[model samples]
Target: MSRVPFYLLVGVLLVAGIAVTIYRHVAFEVPWVPGEQRQVWEVEAQVNFIAEGESAKVNLALPSNQEGFRILTENTGSSGFGLSFLDDDKGRRAQWATREAKGSQQLYYSVQLLVAPNAAQPRVEPPPPDQDVSWARPYDTAAKEVIDQAYRRSSDAFTFSRELARAFSGDRQDENARLLLTQFDRPTLLVKLLNQAGVSARKIHGLLLEDGRRRQSLTTWIQVFDADNDWVIINPTSGEQGRPDNLLLWEAGDQAALEVQGGRDSKVTFSMLQHNEPASVAVRNQLANDTLLNFSIHSLPLEEQSLFKTILLIPIGALVVVLLRVLIGIKTSGTFMPVLIALAFIQTTLFTGLAGFLLVVAVGLVIRNYLSYLNLLLVARVSAVIITVIAIISIFSVVAYRMGLNAGLTITFFPMIILSWTIERMSILWEEEGPKEVLIQGGGSLLTAVLAYLAMNNPWIRHITFNFLGVQLILMAFILLLGNYTGYRLLELRRFKPITED
Candidate 1:
């Protein structure tokens, strides 16, 4: 067949594939009306009551800031004695009693409150009395040095806050936050620890939202105001307990409350079922009905909604591989080798998986090259190379296991035939055009593989491929455009530069 006809046929097939994918993913009927708005406030309570048989008053404090929420109505079950809502000077209160049960009886209630637009204050228990008594700050010279290194690297409030939070938490949880903390001072860690122990603390961000210009970036530490000590400014992230004038307090709370919103609206519904059966059995039964409410795109603008729908374009990656091979004269061992490799990289991550793949390929190539000295026929030579590649992979797995490289398992996904064919091509080039030519071609193939891996594994690409059906149409258009490019490639242009000069 003529190269033109072959290219045309491949282009037609690619256009068809893109069309189907777009129809499957991108095309969606978004309503003219705005998206729905949903706000969820998850409240969990753990109550402990200590009684010595006398009718003692039990007081539970509610959040003081009553700006946005209102207790609409409350329903009481038969298990509790008397319930009363008390209004306190600082915050709201709810009072209830229990009839003397010999052992311990627990009561649970969920209060449904209307959510307001503004922020809500998180409720926190008062700190122990000993918290006010300042003891000599504990000494840890190593930790102090680490903190200094962190501060020197980062001066941003977010960085300082993250570091301070990490140091205070003793680097137990919050891996992302810990990464941020490793750049600051010991005082930051101590302050973060104090905040975690029920003291109000935070790293505040200051910016000129109105002016659109750079504003003063200051890190001020402020303690929460209590009955004894007024709000004290302490630089915890700085490793200094005493106040620093550079720190600014935007707002103070026991703990930070984060509220995420989007331009488009969304809502989530939750239902709970309780049975008299054993807790474990009930949990098992509930697992069957468990549904996850994913609200990722609820807040995006309408113009961006179409972008969110392009997730169906994953199959286009296959078309891209095919086009690269037939139209662009790229040589891959197997028909679907590049696509399969790309998909594998998607699962294993590009950098780590590509490194493992290259390592395996290198080892396989070495073995194949050594075996070439045996002077076997083409089929036998290819087969022997495959076996050698497999054996090399097995050894790699063993070594990886001993060294604790978990990524070693990805070697199984390496196409044996592809490796064998690559070795054969490289050997042919080595004999004909020399090692330089072989290396150049090998480098080109590896570069294309890396590009394919990156394009296929991109988050935006995945999102478009999985979400929207119309993206396939866009892909079809791209394929059609690339199909008409009859001009020489950038490499071909260089090769024909002498002729062009004439």
Candidate 2:
């Protein structure tokens, strides 16, 4: 057979597996090990206001796809107040309504977010028409002076925003910036200047997430729509262009952060705490929001996930079987019987599975020797052996229960049909090739099963096979390569060694 097509197929499988594995790791930030943990922030917002004792309503801005954070869950707390979430052209908002409320009313909103290092940035939209700004007297002339100076130095919307901010920042400030700062806040003034210069700009609010922080207020930053319609964040005082990792945007649109009707002196404060959770949870949550995850194991229910966690390890056991039988010349009763036995060993611990297997096979051989006197047909003989094996397992289970040996209960995990076939094969071997050859093959099967169990039960191997689906393809490629190997086995090489005659 031509080896060209076979090697080409192997190469294709290998490359595909590697591409998928790398993309998942880099895109999702999925860890290579199960023990890796990710940081999470639990932030709580407190809205406090004095009520005028009438029907009260409060609306508060909610967090959305801000860069570097994935919202896991959000909840609102207010007694006797109905809460509902609204999504519109602006952004997400939570509104609380009550028929009647009195002095010192408080509403709470809590959000739990996972810190994702590779999270996609907040969505950007096309720039809206610039808001018309009319400044009075000297301020109009001063704003134009700053705008003209920034426009000369900038090439695009982003650079223009940077230059505009730089004109009013730190040591670069001149009379125009100081004059504008005297009346309007830095963020508002920057927004006005950018809008007057034909740039769509808005004031954005965010909270600085500090561990165990309490009673914090939102910080104002300017958001400018650049030439490509992408949103650019600029610090009004420092001329910085991007959001810091710790800044969590609370409001990104032109809408108000908090609005209260039938109430006065409305204000909102925030508190947050930092903690850690398994990174698998973050990946699972992130994938849950993606349509592509419908085919992933993470989308399955908990019970199915647990079941597949063991099922995925079967290929690893098969790989071990191929390596041992094909590469090392190990002989067993059946081709894949050792792999099945290794799976049983996972449910029943190694030592317990070994002892139970040896006991059943030893006792089963004795019964088969007696059945040979009847001269039964092959099918009937195999059927009788299966029934006998089941009976032995039942009797042993009852005996162990009475004797208070719980480990004996797991003996039922062994596959009855496989055990029957193994007993039949060993019996025929003994009758045809003698007991010496039977011991050789039976011991070899046991050794193969033990080695396979160690491989399948390994923590790292189990994690890799379950978390990365591409690993199965890689294993299949290796198995195909092993199948195509025509060289001498390790054991065969010793038997065929060249003799050095004296």
Candidate 3:
């Protein structure tokens, strides 16, 4: 192709490759890099009730827009009931009704949570706008004494809140704490004290977001204003300040998350399934909400996906070879031979693969030198070397098996014919260019192969290549760009330095 067309093609490939990666990363939340962790949780709130004699109506509270998480999708499963959702001052509620009598009725509200980037930030909104925190006698007098003491010890609203939380948790042995704990639970007392102390405080019910939790009830905590007029979160149970990591605020005010009407017996429980996925995959999968994801390797069968994982990494190995040869001035036995060898290394593992390769080549080199004296034909000479290589491999395998090393079994995949050819070339080089040059070129080839293997086997590299096929186009574009270069290499610079100086 002409230079213009060639560069244009490379440019197109690079642009398209990058565009697809960005789109998938932003829109689908597919992680472009490997090893990033994201948590996607599937939560279910089940409302089961017994209905007899007449019809029944069930009103169950449903989770809606809350901080720390985003609801990707929601679903309901009810056998024989009409369902509708209503949003009012109380909270988001799901109402289910049936006209006829029934034995038992079950309803489910399920949500898939996509953890937001700011999920760790305290989910605190401005508290109710009012000021009726005056207290009643004796208890009022006791509350004033406790708040005044705690306030005197605290420097700011945050510290004051923590101090009160600490006192309520009973970690501190004091008369005030004893009286408060005896009167009410930590949650109720803390809110009452904070409101009485002129800080906007409210009792909020939340869930401790976790995996595999079943029949869990809401955890109660107190939200109050801090020194900066910003809301601060305090755990009544732990007596620690700030929102707990992975806490999802479920409801606020006095009403419970579930309220039942027109039903005799009512109960609500939660079931959660936690999934740990790579940041990108988890985000994308949660957003897609479909089993078969578009343009994702996840849609492929397990076997196919595994196969593609290795197959996609070849281009990366090839790129490593290109950089070593073109930019660094490395010499090798043959073009792409080390790449193929490195591929074998991937299977047999680096150490065993290298040891096996060197053993076969060393043994073959010795035998080929002996054959050289006989003046055998080129084809016959290569055939003898090939046979000798197999024998060496078989002997090594048997020895390794006896020695209790299982890695020796993978030597069969080492491309014996390539070893034979490498041995032949090295022998010729030793005879013509001398042993020193042979060693230099052979060592360079091994170094290149090891480098390529390292790049190919990287977790991030493997992930990107297999997960994002567009990355291969980017690699192709890069290789094409390198192909057009005619400048001196990094290693060549040293060899030519004296020439320029002179």
Best by lDDT: 2
Q: 302-341, model 1: which lDDT tens digit per residue?
A: 5565454333434566567646754565655445555656
lDDT of 3 by residue, 296-415 (tens): 676668898788878788898899989999998899998888888998999999999999988888888899999999999999999999999989999999999999999998998798
> Per-residue alpha-carbon lDDT of model 2 for 82-104, expressed as tens digits?
99999987889999999999899
TM-score of 2: 0.91
Badly placed stretches (over 4 Å) of model 2 are 1-3, 50-57, 78-82, 98-105, 129-131, 152-156, 169-173, 402-404, 498-502
TM-scores for every predicted model? 0.39, 0.91, 0.59
RMSD (Cα, Å) for all candidates, in order, is 22.8, 2.7, 10.0
Candidate 3 lDDT score relative to the true structure: 0.80
Clashes (backbone N, CA, C under 3 Å), per candidate, total 43, 0, 2
lDDT of 1: 0.47
Best candidate according to TM-score: 2
Worst 10 residues of 1 by lDDT: 259-268
Model 3: ten consecutive residues of lowest lDDT: 285-294
Where model 3 places Cα greater than 4 Å from the true spot, the runs are 51-112, 116-268, 271-294, 371-384, 494-498
